[model samples]
Target chain A: MDLSAINPTLLLASLMVAATPLLLAAIGELVVERAGVLNLGVEGMMITGAICGFAIAVNTGSPILGLVAAALGGAVLSLLFAALTQYALANQVASGLALTLFGLGLSALIGQGYQGIKPPSFPKADIPLLSDIPFLGGVLFRHDFVVYLAIALTAVVWWVLKYSRIGLVLRAVGENHDAAHALGYKVVRIRVAAICFGGACAGLGGAYISLIRVPQWTEGMTAGIGWIALALVVFASWKPWRAMLGAYLFGGITVLQLNLQAAGVAIPVEYLAMSPYLITIIVLVIMSADKSRAPAALGRSFHASQ
Target chain B: MKLSKLLATAAVALGMATGAMAEDKTKVGFVFVGPIGDGGWTYEHNKGRLAVEQEFGDKVETVFVESVPEGPDAERVMTQMALEGADLIFTTSFGYMDPTINVAAKFPNVKFEHATGYKRADNVSTYSARFYEGRAIQGHIAGKMTKSNIVGYIGSYPIPEVIRGINSAFSHARKANPDVQFKIVWAYTWFDPAKEAEAAKVLIEQGADIILQHTDSTAPQAAAQEAGNVYTFGQASDMAEYGPKPRISSIIDDWAPYYIARTRAVMDGTWTSTDTWDGIGPGMVGIGEISSEVPADVKAEALALKDAIAKGEYHPFTGPLNKQDGSAWLAAGETADDGTLLGMNFYVEGIEGTIPQ
Candidate 1:
């Protein structure tokens, strides 16, 4: 292996940038799973956000506004899932799958006109003093704002989930919906709000990809990142900080594997190509004991006895 | 029920009217593996479809469905097209091999053409361009132009076709610049922009000054453009929009002439099941404009090599070549046969890494 082909600083920097999308999506999915909901529609909502964000950014010429539109579009799409499950009392699994299929088709239709068009470039946020530190500067200080925002959001989510009363109520609702409804919590309403929040986060993640990462619009551009994010939530034991850790770990492997291939590593290329997914699942399986750590009422729909 | 019957009768009447007006014309159908605007492989095929329409004028009606996944879904699409009265159908992807054969079995009267695949039946014929011939020219230019001696190749898959391309590129590159090294990254996808761009960046970070891709997409070219001074060559189609600098040249798949000829054969009822593999000389493959950004001497040399390959005076896989293990693959002055080239799986000498079975 060529040793000089690998660099610690650049590796760490790309690790953070690569993890941002997964982190954003995982954290949102974590919140949804914690609230006793499993929205497979994360893929659908993410792709909808991708195209909507791309079209708006290209038309309005503002990446910020494009992100906002992406969130709005995602929330609106997820709202479809939320309504079908909460009000109409449909099968959660089927509704989530339908949401994904619908989102894919709708996004393709909307993205038809925006294909092959490049959007405005996103600039990295250079923090003043910290950016000057030799090794740390290159690793932490030279990334787009979304990278920092994703980290900050992780911290905020961790705190809110651990210490806030809202967190307690959410946990209570998720553990036993009927018990919470008996005590006064509104099950459907809280779950709906949580789904919207998850949708918004997933949308931002998709927008980050379209507006800054690849910085162009193409159909099905999310490319199953949403599905990976869904897995990260379970691997994170439904915890936000744990999910962030998982995202970084998977991102690290992704970057490392590319480096290995570029360095002409003698390993089989097929194994190197699949290392990201294989390694992520293997590591996460070891980190999480599995099943026992998930929310008690996860994926179970709740209805009060009227 | 009454409205449905009326609608059905009107549709039949419309079909009858069109059939009577163009009774001698042919109905052709195209199945694409990606969007028509992908700016790469699928785009070139779609252009050929349009060319068929133009060549036949009112004598032919063409229909196409894009972004069709390979496998069972492809079979269903082919069946639907055959049912819709398509006289000839072109399935343009290697993965569509079995599906085309399966569909062609049920529709005994419909003609099927599969690209880049070897499978064939009485109704199904196999055809592919000699893309390696074009890659040799690209490898020559890349080898001469690179300052770091590391030419990055983004491969879509480890199949025989892709393997052939990588081998051809490396062969000519080492011939032009003995110090040249190849760094290959397989994206495992035919057209994913993000993954392609990411591969380009990694290659650049590893000190590659010239980028070559077997995958379809303009992302690598865009990535090269973003990284100033880095060079790239377009794949499958002429992506001149990124021209004059980053895209110094391209390997264009000229399928129009082939498509027109096949359609004409169908009209004349002379079409029979056969395998056709033609390259630059047959106009099925073309080396796009070598932009002025390339040094004049290098451009002329690349064009000369292209001419030699096209004129059959030289073969890209000529011997004096050894396998990656230094095993003698071909004796000096020996050329590879179609069977060996069609199933090429090993890297030529000087390239590193296993094929990753």
Candidate 2:
């Protein structure tokens, strides 16, 4: 492969753009999982956000407001799953699946009239002097505000998880809900809050696509980005900074394959197109092989009676 | 008892008459594989549906269900439309071909129109466009205008409709300049702006100065404008506003004529089941106003080719073509037939990549 054909600056910029959605979603999922909840319906929440964001943005003519609406939309949808899994004690897996189905159908119905219309563009925030630094400036400093916000969120999440008392309680809940409940941590409430956070992040990611990435509403607009975010959470071993790294790595692969095809590299376009997903799977398998790194309570359901 | 018997007879006769009259309204329904707002394929088809409605007023009543994924769900949707008294149905997209055929079997009385597909039944007719014709024009313009020999193409799927477009564009590009190389990226999606923009940026970074897309959405145009110096053609709509900088021309899908004509045929009771593939010649494929950004001579060349193609004097897929392996695919003075083109699975000689399995 001819690596010289790859433009590092453009690749970095595109990687940021592509990774924003995943980073937003993975960080959300990481929080949810850390609070002893597993929501597989991140895809559904993201798509709902995509449609809601597009609809609001088109009507209001403000992309920022649209993203906020998207986050709220996603959180609202996640509340349904929270109610079922947390209150009714329904199967987490089934409720998550239902959430996805419901989100997809609801988004389609609401998005029907909003098709073929373009939403307002997001403003790019250029970092003063850094934006003028030849190659690095264009790649890192010349992105929309959401890109920087997502990175900043990763730092904040990492800091909170590492130092804060509430973070310790959330981690304690994940480690053993029964013990946390006995210690007066309000296990159900904490989990519900985490679920809402995950939904909002997924919504923001979805909104980014509809508001900034594609800036239009189309059916299935999320297009498996949610699933990729879920996988990123696993690849990151449920850590926030690692989630950021995994998202960019996946984004880089995606951008790189397209670049290779454009540079006339002698690889089948289909293989290159599928490389991102395949690489994600490989990374996940490798991560899983190091069994000690995985969260002990991952995918396990906790009950008050137990 | 005598009064009750007479009332029952009158009601039976009235029901029969109402059933017959309901069948005469020419209810045309549409089954879309994707949402109509995709601003590309389904959007254009929905526009055609609106045109049919406008042209045939009371003679036809149209209804549509969007985002019907192509599979059993398609079968269910078609069946429902048929049950709801759709006299004529248009199933758009190739993936609907089999389901259309399946539904056609169950509703032998209903007339079915399948778009961009070849499957036909006693009640089913197929319709498509020679979109490759328009792509030829785009190729001519791109070839003439590009400062860099590299051109980017965002393709939706490996289906024949998209493949034919790639081949047509490449043929014209090669004709304009032997050194012109195409960078084709398969997004494997019909309409996702994020993916499409990503594809365009990749091409731009690799030195492509012009872009073409078989995918839906205005992302490629937006990307071209953002990159500067990169030119693009509108895929399904006149996306000129999105590209004040790089949009040179657009292939507008004018489905009004076909929609109106088909409805008229149904109204006249002369709607026979047959495949119709119309292009710029018959006004089905519309070439939007060429932007002033293109060089005067390049615009002239593009128009000349368009006129020739419209007049049937030029064939985009004509002669001297070879498969990707350098084997003789078509001899000089030979043209590809509908059957071969419909099943086009291999790349042309100049295309360096293999089709993904």
Q: What are the clash counts of all predictions, listed in order?
A: 0, 0
Model 2 scores a C-alpha lDDT of: 0.84
lDDT per residue (tens digit) for residues B1-357 in model 2 = 999999999999998886677666888899986667666777788899998878778778898997787789999999999998888899987889999999999999889999999888889999988898999999888888888898888888788788889888988988888899887778877766788888988888888899899887777776677667888888877765654457889898887788778878877889889989988899888887888888788888999999999999988888889988999988998988988988888888887566665
Model 1: lDDT to the true structure: 0.88
TM-score for chain A, candidates 1 onward in order: 0.96, 0.94
Give the TM-score comparing model 2 with the true structure, all chains together.
Answer: 0.83
Give stretches of model 2 more than 4 Å off. A1-3, A36-41, A47-70, A76-145, A158-163, A171-183, A215-220, A231-242, A290-306, B1-28, B55-63, B70-88, B102-111, B259-272, B320-334, B346-349
Q: DockQ for the candidate 1 complex?
A: 0.42
Q: For every candidate, what is the interface RMSD in angstroms? A: 1.9, 2.7
Error of 1 at A123 (Å): 1.3
lDDT of 1 by residue, A1-306 (tens): 795887878878977877888889888888888889999988888889888888898999888889899989999999999999999889988999999889878988998767567687777799999999999999999898999999999998888888999988888888889889999999999999989989988998888877777666766667778899998898778878778888998877777778888887888877877888887888777878755487888888888864
* Model 2 error, position B42 (Å): 1.0
Candidate 2, residue B143: Cα displacement in angstroms equals 1.6
lDDT to native, each model:
0.88, 0.84
**Candidate 1 CAPRI assessment class:** acceptable
Looking at model 1, residue A102 earns an lDDT score of 90
Q: Which stretches of candidate 1 lie over 4 Å from their true place?
A: A87-91, A112-115, A173-175, A290-306, B1-31, B52-88, B102-107, B263-269
Task: Please compute and give the TM-score of the first chain of candidate 2 against the native first chain.
Answer: 0.94
